[model samples]
Target: MIKQMPFVETDRLYLRGLEEEDVCDIYAYLSMEETREFLDLEQQQNIDQTWNLLYEEYLPYIEKSLFQCWVMEQKQSGKVIGHLRLYEEQQCLFVEMLLHPAYWKQGYMKEALMKMLQHVYTFLKHQNVYVKVRKENKNCIFLLESLGFQYITCVKEMLSNGKMYNMWIERLSEKEWRKQNEKNT
Candidate 1:
């Protein structure tokens, strides 16, 4: 089994490996119609289904070292607000993030993402980290672009749901990240 990763802290938030206690918070989002729109869930009827999915589907991926999920909590309020995942596939790291709808537009996600990117690049030594955002998620697209990610292409018939969505890929080399940081100093 893969060793459990440690908690990561940012300026305003803390990210730690998901625990069984997080089922309720996760279910709150997973069961929401608005949040499920871009996600792959067919439907979540009850807490038992959510619990099974979290344990059976998601936990196994974590145990196999194929994916890692982190629960995002506000440092000040100690409230669980969202989740972020790093998926290892085809020798690449794919990032997936979701925030509570109530916390949208507060810059919390950018803070969490910035910290995650740093950890993935500097600590994990992963050179190529990518994210796939829906074509209509303009807010997320703009956020990624502002973080130095460039537009790659739109993927057609990319999802199993028979929906064609835009796919934007970004690569951050260690050298590039260092140079970018130097400029900010």
Candidate 2:
């Protein structure tokens, strides 16, 4: 097992490992149709179901070092706003995130993603990290581009709606991220 990740903090938020207690907070987003759109994830029917799903499916991610999920909480209100996930797959680190709709346009997800990128590169010593965003998710695409991620290709996915949509796979390399940060700082 890999070592547990240390808490990641930003100016307005704290990213820490998920606990069982976060089930309800997580369900708040996972149950929403808005949150499931770009992600194409299954919706949690209720809080009780969310708890069972997390306990059976995601709880291991917190215990195992190769995979991790951080619950993002606001520093002031102490409310759970989102989550950032990191896991090793196919010789690369895959990053994923979800945020409550109320927190949209607030820069909270941006800050969390930035912190995760640094951690995945600096702590995990990964050369590259990948994020797959639906082509329609302009916000995510813009965020990735702003962080120096380059578009790799578009993947076709057939969603539960039986409609085809394009998913863009973007990659950010450590060298590129460092270069951009150095130039800005």
Candidate 3:
């Protein structure tokens, strides 16, 4: 089992493990119609369903070293506002990110993503990371591209929820990461 790591701090948010107390906050955004648009869920989820997903499905992944789900909290208010996750499968790391509507356009998601990517590259030592965004989700695609991710291809049956989305993959070798940081400095 992968022991839960400590919270990661960004400029405006904190990315930490999802605790039982985060259920209400998670459900708030997840239940919203707008939030569900690009998501794979076909139907609006009820609190009970969300709870089961968190406990039965998500928690086990955390305990088994298969996934890491984080609750994004605004540092100033200490309020849980979104969720991000990195799942490891056969030496690859896949990222999933979502932010509440209220926090949109505030750069919280980008900060969280960059911090998490750094963590995976530096601490986890993963060779590559990937994220899938619905083709209609242009904003997310732009974000990923801006972060140096390359578009792989559009997948027809990529998700079980019946959404055909484009997949973007980003590979970061230790040498590449070091050069990126050095250039930034």
Q: Per-model C-alpha lDDT, please?
A: 0.75, 0.83, 0.74
For each candidate in turn, give its C-alpha RMSD to the true structure in angstroms.
Answer: 2.4, 2.0, 2.5
Q: What is the number of residue pairs that collide in model 1?
A: 0
Question: Which 10 residues in a row give candidate 3 its minimum summed lDDT?
Answer: 167-176
Q: What is the model-wide C-alpha lDDT for candidate 1?
A: 0.75
| Winning candidate number (lDDT) | 2
Could you give candidate 1's per-residue lDDT for residues 1-185 as a string of tens digits? 24344588988889888878888777877777877666656567788888898788567664565566778988998877898888866676788888878788898888888777787777787776777777677888888766766666667545667766665565555666666657645
Q: TM-score of model 2 relative to the true fold?
A: 0.91
lDDT by residue for model 2 (130-160), tens: 9888998998898889889999999897987
Model 2: per-residue Cα lDDT at residue 181: 76
TM-scores for every candidate against the unseen true structure: 0.86, 0.91, 0.85
Can you give the lDDT of residue 29 in candidate 2? 87
Q: Residues 9-42, candidate 3: write the lDDT tens digits.
A: 8778888888888888888888887786777754
After TM-score superposition, the amount by which residue 58's alpha carbon in candidate 2 deviates from its true location, in angstroms, is 1.9
The better candidate by TM-score, 1 or 3, is: 1
